[model samples]
Target chain A: MLPDSAPLSAATATSPAEEVLTVEHVSKSFGDNHVLQDFSLTLHRGENLVVLGKSGSGKSVLIKCIIGLLPVDAGRITVLGQEVGALGHDELDQLRTKVGFLFQSNALYDSMTVRENLLFPLRRHWMADRRGQEESMVMQALDDVGLVETIDKMPAELSGGQRKRIALARTLIIPPEIILYDEPTTGLDPITAREISQLIREVQQKYTTSSIIISHDMNCVRLTADRVALLVEGRCYAEGTFQELQQLDDPIVREFFV
Target chain B: MNSTILAETGAITNFAWRFFRHGFRPRYEVQELLYQCYVVGYQSLPLVGITGFIMGIVLTLQSRPTMAQFGAESWIPTMVGLTIVREMGPIITALIFAGKIGSSIGAELGSMRVTEQIDAMEVAGTNPFKYLVVTRVLATTLMLPILTLLADAIALYAAYIGINLKGVTTLALFTNNIISTLTFGDVVPAVIKTFFFGFAVGIIGCYKGYNANKGTEGVGRAANSAVVVSSLVIFLLDLLAVQITSALGLN
Candidate 1:
């Protein structure tokens, strides 16, 4: 396992040769309030790119656009080499099987048990050969998240941290090529948040999957991010390693470091 | 106010259009639909049955004194049966259903929307509209009519009990009296309109819930407005049904 405080230089020394996802000059707005304006970023295979921003700085919007949940007003989002806006419903659904998203709320179906929640995506994107292995797959995913004991429990029964872990496990069940985490450590305690940050790194190493994590949590950024992009005023204001950005003299970037 | 109403109308129309487009396609959510049917139809029987029973008994007792003045006490069975089947049973049950199922669906889906469960489903490669909205709408549409019919039967049975409480009338005679006066026009028109009522309740509940916003407060608003709008729609549809039946000479 990689050291908990491994620097970005050591962590991503051998950059994988791939551009799994890209947002090119994407702009999105709700009414007069522009949330994202010409914001662009890239995720290479096996890299954790954290988009650091204050709440409402369009961090979540950028993730949603990448996953095709929200359409961009201008520019394009291409995931796994397919233009998100150009795809049809069926095509998008197919593409989504290769991309997992973890919502800030955990968003586990309240009515379903953890097992059923994990099985939902697997069944939705079912392949005939994997029919009988669903049980094993679910167990393995739960094991990965260290929540196998909570499989039968409803989401409401779990603690906030457990719920967040379960949501991550659900995302990992399908083994998506890319994972988008929206405020994964937002509501957890410091200890749980740090644990989640470590878990994020563990998942990256295990699955070799690209990820875009949206967070303003400095500790989480230090622990999980290989590269951090600062989102400010609906734009990618600065981009660098966490330590590099921390040393920068810019006031806007320093505000976050402070 | 007018603009808000117009905007709501346009939004509902668009939502309905999406439903039609997605609802009829393949990969149907049969399991969810069945589960919803049980929740909406079977679980609601007790409330609907009690309301129907009370309605029948109250109508009989109230009409008894009036009928006695004309020495038409024996005609109570026919009048009560016709009234229950034609209007009272369907309307009262639909209103109650609006309160129960419509609000339930609205709140459930509204909570889902606010909590991002719907978005999660979409990310999971499931069409949440098909899995949640369509199943619920179909269940309400299919189940409401059945519930109304059952309520009508219970009300008629209660009317029989009410009649017996006052004077001893043979069961055969009461049945014959009511059956003889009831025509295909009376039964068919009432039954047919209930389908529309069911559709209205289902569609309106879904429309409100699916678009719910503003968090927990929005959930409450969705549930409350679903019941209110559906109840209003039930009455309006009932009025329209009456006019259509009269025009078609089925009145």
Candidate 2:
């Protein structure tokens, strides 16, 4: 097996960088069922790392633990050099401003318009002196996502693909340093999924944001990922570039490629 | 089952503590608070008015024959005035408020929870409790008494109408009798209890909704549980208020 934290062959795109997020020996269990056991991974700055897993392989659990939505049973998660569990509530809230999360459902506030959605993060973090700049920042984010026309519309009025785009725009509004994408392209047609994948790459390049993308879609993995990690039975079974992992002879890793 | 009950109680207590803690911070949600007040207070006036009107008419009609049988027919104004003012007005109005506002808050928050809107808010560095729970709780705590006051006024008018339909008491005489019967002791205790009623409704609804799980079905469950618990809590609080008021000779 390749060594842990192996540099991918396509590492030419991103410059050498320090670690941004580190999940070390994290273990989680629910009653009698163990979800994640001894899982460790480090996310380098300004690289797209796609985590590939099967349907019930605890991908969402990992994301939840990282964001402190769920507490880990027996390990530590450090984001931006701060231990996730060590921070108080307000501190965590402040830290989250720099770490954006794109949920699988888009999680757009249905009660809010697209403009309101974009403004939510800016207003919540209490970014003062954004009077005139707020409008332009919102416009820029919407423009980046190519959905400036949807500013006045509510999330319910948007299609599935449009909702995904708007959700990404909401995350990008604040220009977070690290983004955690939970199944960014799960519930869409292939065309839309491909488009979302391309957008993910565009976001990574444009913002130079380090992202940990958890997805099962091969097309998404192929288009967005600079490195791929195979999570089997709650552990990182292998890690390499898309091409490196694609040529593996192991059946479990081969199952994904075939 | 016992563990579940204990866990739930503990959860609600923690939720209440966090709500108060978060409630006392900056970044206050002034717009949302005002909007909730308008929703929980202003929009509920019509329902509370109709219910109060019906209650006045019915209580007057039902108690009339009994008062007449006791050779106390002339005491109709005093008796109806006291009953509606001291008990019926606050209790019935509070129950109606609990049903409408409590269920609405619960369902709204539960839907937000299931759809991950609450998570989104937290991730975006917004305190959902301060924005959603505190504003709603404070609105109900402050508005229920006002609504009860309005309902009491409407009910008194309907009582006046009820009296006119049967007897020939002048408006001045009816007004004098009501004013004389309802002392500060009677009105103050009754009104004071409604604040508690409002607090209970708001807190229970928020607790249910914010902690709701089990997906779409949980939304319905939260709404249902909110109404049931708040309504029950209202009765229990009414009983306690009566005892305290009686002990203090305010009844």
Candidate 3:
């Protein structure tokens, strides 16, 4: 079994004062059932912010809004100094290159091999100089996630943990300024989950990339979060460091730690 | 119920409008388009060929005894040729095309949507609509008519074999009879209507697949609805084409 606690390293301790992404009072609803209501959060230049919530508590919706996948019903989501809601289709697509998203399902293209999957974004953004170096770039990304051997394999051939790692590698290939991970550690064995948590930390330190990870897994939250925001009933019910939130006396906050 | 159907029709029209708009603008997806054409057109030829052959033979055989009863057995070549050229050929081939191509496109796209592959494409800065929808829709639109034409030729050959089974006619005489029976009006209008049939199949498949909701079940639903809708649209369009052709004295 993997250790339940992850002590923060020195590199992740000092985040720059610049805010990279801000969700200011954003709200979204599907018909009568409102998923997100005036929820708000922020990510600094280099930090891992975890949004903790129950299965249907609007965490995915929040991420969708930030990525401009779903239009917000109210409020503003600004990413990399531009309002996400204000951009046109092409503009939003351009903005997406700077921000990577890791889906809970991994979302690796079923039709493609690992190398092709990694090459997808690099080619899409038209990084002209990446032509000769594309092979090396793919190899290096696979190397980062310690899956260089699986470079030529299809996604379906891998185990769930391996698939997750490959998915992370695919995202890291483009090296986005901020990465959004949706349930990064769910549906994994404890050891694999712990390893992914460590990989997440390694990615943060190496790339100095900010991340907003959505998860209900307390272990993932404890291991990866620099600051944890508890999303309760479509709002940020509480916000603090894991240790700070762990020591809170309130029943709602304490429920997670216990 | 009426309102729901109207809403669906309105939604499909809007979807079609988007397809037209994005289809023209792009760093066009040439590679994907070629691959789709290969899959949709080349792969479907054998099935279309076999169906065409059977349809031709069956129609010839069934019409033989009836024409013989009317002492018009010698007119079998002309009658069969006209029927295949004007109506049965396009409608049967289109319905078959709808069943094969439409359902396949719908299921493929629906699977992509449910698995979030489409969303991943968007988030990765590739236009999913351009890469997936446009390529597929265009492939069907172009491929269906070609398939129908090929099917019509194979069908004509089978009809010839059927005619030769009981009575022998020289190829020259058979060719002359068929040529004399079928006017430019018969061939042109039939061929023209096929393009619309092809477009309907492509567009309906794309629309249903693109807009499918739910999960794995939705994939099946999209495929099912695509065939149903495209087949229906094919008949309706055929009816309208026939009416217009008659009005213009083309038939």
lDDT of 1 by residue, A122-157 (tens): 887778989899999999999999999999999989
TM-score of chain B of each: 0.98, 0.96, 0.97
User: Which candidate has the top score in DockQ?
Assistant: 3
Q: Regarding TM-score, does 2 or 3 come out ahead?
A: 2
What's the lDDT for candidate 3? 0.89
Q: What is the TM-score of each candidate against the true structure?
A: 0.95, 0.96, 0.95
lDDT tens digits, residue span A124-239, model 3:
67777677788899999999999999988998899999999999998888889999999999899999999999999999999999999999999888889989888887887788
Model 1 chain B: ten consecutive residues of lowest lDDT:
B191-200
Candidate 2 at residue B238, lDDT? Answer: 98
Provide the clashing-pair count of each candidate structure: 0, 0, 0
Winning model by TM-score: 2
Error of 1 at A135 (Å): 1.3
Angstrom error of the Cα, residue A217, model 3: value is 1.5
Cα displacement (angstroms), candidate 3, residue B22, comes to: 1.0
What's the DockQ for every one of the candidates? 0.77, 0.78, 0.79
Q: Quote the lDDT for A121 in model 2.
A: 78
Q: Please state how well chain A of candidate 2 matches the true chain A, as a TM-score.
A: 0.93
